[model samples]
Target chain A: MAQFLVEGRELVAEAARGLSALALRRDDAAAMEACFRALHTLKGSTGLFDLEAMGQLLHAAEDRLAALRDGQASTPGDIDALIEMVDQVDRWFDALERDGRLPADAGSIGQAAAHRIRDAGGAPVMAEEQPAQPSWRIPPDFDGLSGIAIRYVPRPDCYYFGDDPIAITAAIPQVTALRLSARVPWDSSEPYDPFTCNLVIEAVSAAGRAEVEAGFRLVADQVAFAELVPAAQAGSAGGGPARRTLRVDAARLDRLADLADDLVIAKGGLAELAAQAESLPGGHALGQALRLRQARLDRLAGDLHATVGRVRLVPLAPLFARFPRLVRDIARSLGKKAELVVEGGDVEVDKALVDALSDPLLHVLRNALDHGMEEASTRRRAGKAEAGSIRLAARVEGDQVVIEVADDGAGIDAATIRALAVKRGVLTQEDAARLDDVAAIDLIFAPGLSTAAAVTTLSGRGVGMDVVRSAAASLGGRVTVTSAAGRGTQVQFRLPVAMTLIQILVVACGEERYGLPLDAVVETARLAPGRVVPIRAGWAFQLRDQVLPLVGLGELVGTRRAALAESQRVVIAKVRGEPIAFAVDAFVDRLDIALRPMNGLLAHAPGMLGTTLLADGSVLMILDLAELVA
Target chain B: MTVRLDGAVLRLEGSCHLEDAESLTALLQTSGVSLVDLSACQSLHGAVVQALLALGPRVEGIPASPFLRDLLLPALLVKRQAKPSNL
Candidate 1:
């Protein structure tokens, strides 16, 4: 990923945001003006660097926007083409960054994209969107027709299968004519079923039959081709978003992180020396001076972390922007009228977190749209709006970022989940039946439990709710689903804002020390023996009226036997939703440590989440409660 | 297909397909007030019709093919939809 230069990523990401902003809110005059300035600035910047082709291409795009801004002409209102141009430029920039030079075909690519920008500047003509109907009619036969005639009928569940028909058709080579129409009748516009696709697309292309067919090979069976007789037909043309970034070599940033870490360790060592000096005869004054210097070092370390974090921070808009297009297409595929609403797209998170979050979040939204979101008719019948909505929202919660994908559709039924759990052999019928609603709902996070009845194109290809849960967990985060039968489902992912240099609560268990995320530590308490109670096979301690579960640190980590100490010493940690008290030898001082995820064979070691180095040069194994409790 | 975007007019020669719709629309958009000369056009794809319709360009030199002529003229013929231009 580092090979893709940071500057290239920044340039592409910023341009993509601006282009999408213009595309999405064409009516927002301010956003449109910003887009013009951004494009113009990018063009001028590229020209300054002597990237002639890029500068020229962006100039053309800016010209169109200039016309729109000047009110010289109406905006073309084609978001797809504008997106394609910026996306193409992004690829070109990637090639330039990787090879230290632009590809030989850069000129042609830019010229082609320039034409698209022009087209995108055209006025709006396509307004009414009729639902797809079964169109088996022979493709239009026109005079002097000299290319391949194609009729593509996408599978009703193509969206589930992760196939985008719009993109596929839009990318066809040498496209001459494309007619996207609904094959299905408009009987129920009051509450349209968007999930049920009744649309068929027929296109005429100047591209050869083979090129077009190869492009549609994913759904070959759904396409029919009619070859025109030997005549001169024009050939096809081709074309192909990133985030805000500060241009810094990723290697240098890594080195800075390492140095900051080393400084933190060195600062700890100085404090130790200060303590030793304080013990010396007549060393009290010297010790105080060294402590002041150590305090300065600590401040510097924090500043360094903040600086590096800002350099790596990126707005969530680029990530969130991708979903609306996806949900819109998938909704169209399912014939379900679903709209994606995004909030707090301007919220910034670590770039690495954004990348890590993309795939799993996509999967969760797929489930939300397919299984979680009910049909329009069902929604209407349930006294809900006909148009179901999914929102991709993000916010900063303390030091952590909370990203949520919420839908206003049919929510999960715990009974259905339990039944599936039993049916899928995930749990015994008796066990599933004994589980409460929350526990049963959590069972969806257990692998192999898909509520979808059949393997459709959109989802139910075996990867289930547990996959979504595990993905969040792998990022040192947790996912929770709260649903009401008729309401929608929200899968919230709570993750630390930064992956490096987090504050951890160090604890000692006998001879060994371990680290736990400070955020997870609710409180530390020394309880009396009488407060500990045995519940079933496990032990619980009464915190207030509620009894929290208790786990022995020595027993959970398999290091030592649980000693029957006279006093119960413990730290209360939040595990899932419940607070669990873990008995430890003693609580050590809290320290800001950079935890490195355990890799290779030890990565999946039971109970260990990650490992961090202490000032004393010893390794502290961070514990994962899910693994510890299991 | 040949696309000429410079000069006082944007020119398209030979047969053009739906795939070229974006390029053609772009040519018209970036061309500003330049006339889209399609007189040498042997055939025009359906997507191009929509692209041209959106732009409402002054399409010069209408093609001889009835298939294109019928679709092209009706869309560009409506003066209310297109800008005032000499036919």
Candidate 2:
């Protein structure tokens, strides 16, 4: 299905990112494993869809990566060559997605990848004397499976959710009989979700059933896994029975849904016609027959819609798989020894949400590593464990999902923050003196309030945490931080289950009405123009003795100032860590609508996040407050 | 040096300058040159000596010039003694 291919492409991109990062770090093992995971998934999935050209290229890449993984040979040059091969494969996948056909010269890239693998052996030992093809099969004598045989069946569209099933399965130690399959039949006419992966792996290992289940805990729902006892009559053969798994394209799935909806409407019309026919004399038999046919058709269409919807659901494991390397690199860069503990990785959300979460989660993890955790020496000096730990736990909280990033290191110092607040003039000396430690520590969220005296290239410029907050908020998510001095910092983000439909508050700025994301709006108030007072070159109004900066909506959107009225309403928006009040013409009612980005050149307009259509058929520009501040 | 067809032996009579290719060529016209004694010869040019060396007659040296005799002759002798087919 199209979803499968999309998921494969994402995996390839992720793998490419990992390879490039590792290539920079000179970590051969991790780079090779990442590459192998990507190519292996592509190869297996492509085979399922009978995409021969793509499958071949991926298979070649898999071989090359496998060689490096096994330490048969590896060098910086080899890594570069392999990375290039992966990039080419990515381009091919993109082209295929755009054109629905493989490129004419697709085999060359695969050939190049294979050549690198052979060349890595250094001066080919003449063809006749070369060793036998490296075996991919599990050895017959190897019997490490003392535990149960658990089969993991990922939903067919798992890939679109950014879950790399092969990588997750491979991470399970002593995995035996790993097989990928589709949950349903492949229909070229039907649209499929590319994110869905229906890969079932029958793994036999020394790891307990709970551990095996826990290994796939992040994708447990989408993955249908079962523990089975090995039959004594069976031999040591690794391959599982071949099943004809269904593959469908995504466009077709959409068409099918539309078709089903149309059929439902038709059935409704038939039901009404049947009632009319029954009212006529001697039409009872015809009415009964029409109703029976309508019922059957309705049931079929309902089943079709349900099946297609299931095909769209994918587990989040693939996206989660990419984070271990990210955490490792970041922790190493910060000179902090921290282990990433991920939970609820199997939790399935909509595929689009999973993809959107990747960057935000990465930013959060990076911030946790750079600013949340303290160095080992510092931790030891503070009488804490030398090795710090970061726990990234995710769970379904009601309709929303909460991902919590907790780190154990030197926590936020409230006194330092209070001093910074006074220095930055965000709070007067008198006000700062009255603030408690908890309130003072919140000042860290203030833009440009960094405790570090000197800014390093890695972090501490005071821009990272703000970016993290903005990114999370953009997805209708809120991030909250709790820290204790000498203890640690815990940052938790609560995000919506899906992004297609969102509730937004529409506000009028000038002639144009804009939707200020409800998540970012703290409150709105009416302020008289005369009440706006000057504070340190910036105009601020004294509300509760706290000076909040006044930003005019007209000025922000490049509109001419409107004539002053008796009273002006200012929408106080929290951006980064600072509060800025935007003067708007009037408040508009809230609406729930499908948020879509504007087309044409206007989509690139600054401070405009996206565009949405209102119930009255008018377009509303969604304002990005963070962009405005920047 | 002059030799009769009646199996007569001829000896090199005087010092000959290997650098003088014209004289060597003129000498070859009158008599079949044999037993070249290069011991007293000094500063033999490569061009004139190569001509004589290719004349297909056994070469005897009064001793070659010191630089040429030490550096070039041993290598030339090895080449000459080696089987051309093998090379």
Best candidate (score: lDDT): 1
Error of 1 at A34 (Å): 4.7
**Ten-residue stretch with the least lDDT total in model 1 chain A:** A233-242
Candidate 2, which CAPRI tier? incorrect
User: What TM-score does each prediction get for chain A alone?
Assistant: 0.62, 0.49
Interface RMSD of 1: 10.3
A360-406: candidate 1 lDDT, tens digit per residue? 98899898888888788888889988888888899999888999989
True lDDT of residue A24, candidate 1 = 68
Interface RMSD for candidate 2 relative to the native interface: 37.7
Q: What CAPRI class is candidate 1?
A: incorrect
lDDT of 2 by residue, A258-311 (tens): 454444434545667788888889999998998888788768866765555455
Off by over 4 Å in 2: A1-313, A381-383, A424-428, A460-462, A503-591, A597-609, A614-617, A622-630, B1-87
DockQ, each predicted model: 0.02, 0.00
Fraction of true contacts retained by every candidate, in order, equals 0.00, 0.00
